[model samples]
Target: MSIRTVLLHAAPDSGFNDRLAFAVALARQSGAAIKGLYTLYPAGVPRVGRALSIYVNELVREAKEKEGGLKAQFEQATAAAGLAASWETIEGEVASSLREAVAFADITVVSETPYGTVDDQLAATLPEHLAMACNGPVAVVPTGKPVPARIGKVLIAWKPSREAGHAVRFALPVLAAADEVEVFTVEEGDTTTADSGAKLAAWLATHGVNAKHRHVAEGNAGHAITNEVQKFGADLLVMGAYSRSRFAEMVLGGVTASLLVDPPVALLIAH
Candidate 1:
């Protein structure tokens, strides 16, 4: 689908600023409106202690000030890019708040790592949760580096699954805009009987996307995908969020978990 509106998670941190820049760049490219979301999770207060209540109130006040500052930053970035934008501040859980906002957004952008409160349980699995919570795609911006001014090269991790197809279809707009696209599938053993990449490439051609396909025999899918991203110098990586159950992935360490931990490039993921 065409990206008409982008939902961005705004915060008072370098990672969030980077994500805002990334979202602004995308909005400039697609002429999409920007919606900056800031969800506040105030510290819980008890009725028994006056001192603790005062401390919690102070923390909440500080958080509100930070949110106001972040809203200004988001506005500056979006206005500089000459994009239509809006901001929302909700007092609730991050995931649930974003889930409601994502319903109206075409694409959602977030930081690859935790944005605030390093020990935040919700931030820990944010990207995956966002992907699973919404029908749209989630763009996870990598940390510690400036996002590219343009997304030139895109790498598609093609696995024949419903989730993978959903990601590809949702990311069609980005794939068509990218200068280069590589659709690759990995095989665990030396089985050269099927080549789904070529078929997928042919389909993408109908959408005016010139893509190349390749097959790799690798035991570890996540490692192979990351290696390809590095070798190709991809600006964005598009793939499914999680093929297996989240619980199983947590214990067995799936591709989604590994990549989300340290994404090599901007990750566009869908469930």
Candidate 2:
């Protein structure tokens, strides 16, 4: 029920160090063990020609080298943090490997993708996929920036949906630790009840979380959510990922898309 194990998608990329640092910090805060997962696609066995076989062999060798380096880095970082940690190198599809790794994890920590980079797009979308596939929270940290040492304040994007409810439940540990917790709801005309936000706040209170209810006139949901994060100086933003179908989200962007495109703060997302 608490954050006992944190799974990190450890990639040998430009943002590897940042992700490790952030994950270690969070693990320290929660007294959680860290598991670093490095996944690489195995080059398929070649049967047609020796030339193709040689190329595949070279790719596999390069992948193994990368994994070795990443493993060393993970060990060094975890040792420096004095944290209980484990590392795994798997040959499989990145998304599926992460989904399997996160099955036993209480939370997953990942770095945001570098914008407009084809190679980093997968890294960017990995958190979203994990949020949907894993039965826990996923913390997406912005790359190339120092993460907040402590998540003192949290902004929860509250909505009356099963996904939103799940996100709140998954993020309870972080919320419980925050000095200030705000349940932010965007009201669209007369559709939502005036006391809806209060109800969520009361629910959180039962779990020993003191949260304030804040409702704003419905504008762009994503903008409203991020605006609140900036206005309140929140270190963390908790919300459900992809409330709508992927196709629908692609056509008409949702809160998840907006935040992923330009994350304002560390995001704890669940689905």
Candidate 3:
């Protein structure tokens, strides 16, 4: 699908300046518009609607101030990138609104935070919950670095599975722009030991990406992907965020958890 609009989710504590920049970069390239959305976290209990009304007003007031400041900074950054990005504020759960935004746009852009960051608590777009929504491909921009306009290599954590396939599909734009696209999978003992690597490569070729299949017989799947990502000097790593359970890592622990901060490469996640 063509990208005519992009939804960039923002909140009071979003620490993803780099992600905002990346979305602006992509928007400029695609002649698309960027909408920066901020959601206010309601105060007090849901059951006591009346009791929370006054406190809710206070929360909304503070949120408005935060949004004003954030909107200014966001506009300045996007303007510097020569793209038209605008802001809007909403009141609701961050994750639900983000999903709605994704459904309404061509693609979704988010900046992932460390598993336990304050922003994660506010927006809860932390990789796991995000991957679970399954609304659209999400570009999880890494913090602490500048977003690159172009990438040299692309890493696809593949396994001939839905998640892997989705990752490839989600990364179509970035993959097409890279010099090299590599599909890599690691053995996990029991199931998925087939020659699916070649199959994944073929899938990539159909999408105009000449991906090379590479299989690693040993090492942790996430670790292997990271090592190869670094080895290839890949600018982007695309992989499915397998699970988004509160108990699972996407929100709390596993692979998504490990890659939250200073990942080997910027991750583009979809479920």
CA error at residue 64 for candidate 3, angstroms: 0.8
Q: Per-residue alpha-carbon lDDT of model 3 for 55-87, expressed as tens digits?
A: 767767887787877788788977887776778
**Per-residue alpha-carbon lDDT of candidate 1 for residues 53-164, written as tens digits (9 for 90 to 100):** 6865665577688887788888888888899999888877577788888888999998886445642333667788888878789999987865888889999988877888
For model 1, the superposed segments whose C-alpha errors exceed 4 Å read 42-58, 114-122, 190-194
lDDT: worst 10-residue window of model 3: 41-50
Model 2 worst lDDT run, 10 consecutive residues = 39-48
Where model 3 places Cα greater than 4 Å from the true spot, the runs are: 42-58, 115-117, 190-194, 243-254, 260-262
| Model number with the top TM-score | 1
Which candidate leads in lDDT?
A: 1
Ranking by TM-score: 1, 2, 3
* Candidate 2 ranges with C-alpha deviation above 4 Å: 42-59, 116-118, 122-124
RMSD of each: 2.9, 3.0, 3.3
Error of 3 at 2 (Å): 3.1
For candidate 1, give the lDDT of residue 249. 93
